[model samples]
Structures are given as structure tokens and as C-alpha cells.
Target: NQIHSPFWCPTTIETPTKKSEFPVPPCSTPFNHVNSSALSYEAQEVRRCLRQGLIESPEMSHAESLVLAELEDKLRAAVGTRYPQDD
Candidate 1:
């Protein structure tokens, strides 16, 4: 009922936390942009696995071998083209 209502409600406000600041430092050494050796190593390892898969495909069903072959080809192409060579 309107006769039983309270006159005022208490409220609380939270204080803001201090933020840590960072300043941009001048560039010293040129940052190394690419790691060609690592990329090539990984690609070669994947290629090796794909070759092994091809060899073992004879034990798999015809449809499975076909799918594996298609995937291997796509991955091979991607690895070959995606990385840059060290000049």
C-alpha cells in the first residue's frame, strides 16, 4: 500500500582502479620478419607423412585412398606456395 512505502533507498558507488601505463620505446634492431627454415622443415615433414599415407593407401578402401590422395595434393600445394625463401 502507498502508506507503507519507504522514503529513501541507500546506494553505493565503486572507486575506479588505477591503470598501468606503457611508453613506446625506440626501435633498436630490425625485427626478424620470417622464419623460412622452420616453415620449410614443417612442410617437409608433412610431405613425408603424405608420402607414407600414399604408400599405405593400398590397405585402405578405394574411396578412402582417393580422398587421402586429394587431400595430400592440396596440402602439398599449399605448403609449397605459402612460405617465403630466405634471400
Candidate 2:
């Protein structure tokens, strides 16, 4: 007969009873609320550009292409993929 102590067992680990909490400081940047119904095309384009990542190739789907086309001309120029052939 063989017996293994709890300290020597690999699966008998004990966890802490209470977890520590992190206190996050409030954001330093002030927030300016804009009306959703008053968003202009250019504002929308800028929002879209900021949210999307750079596409490296033209192998994207038709839906993706449409979304890309919706981006502002300056944004497209920055991405350097104005058209499918540009990839």
C-alpha cells in the first residue's frame, strides 16, 4: 500500500478564499456627447476608418469591398487600396 500527502499531490492545490480587486482611476479625457441623428457623412467615414483595420489584399468579399468603398477618399488613400486591383 502507498499513500501520497496533499502537499506532494499535483492536483490538490488550494486557492485563496478572497480575490483582490483592482481600483481603476477615472478617465482623464473629458467626454463630449454627440447626437446620433446629427452624424454627417464625413463624421461617419472617420468613425468607420478609426474602427477598421488596414486590409493588406484585395481577396476581401463583396460585402467587405462595399464597406471599404464607404470609407472617405482620404482614408482610402491612406490605406493605399483604393480598388481591388490596387491590392
Top candidate when judged by lDDT against the true structure: 1
Please give, for residues 1-87, the per-residue lDDT of candidate 1 as tens digits: 122112121122223553333222344445353222334444565677687865343345569868987787778687874435312
- Per-residue CA lDDT of model 2 for 42-72, tens digit only, reads 3555566556763332344567777766665
Residue 81 accuracy (lDDT) in model 2: 49
TM-score of each: 0.25, 0.17
**Cα RMSD to native, each candidate?**
23.6, 21.6
Which residue pairs in candidate 2 have backbone atoms (N, alpha carbon, C) closer than 3 angstroms, thus clashing? none
TM-score for candidate 1, residues paired by index: 0.25
lDDT score, candidate 1, position 13 = 24
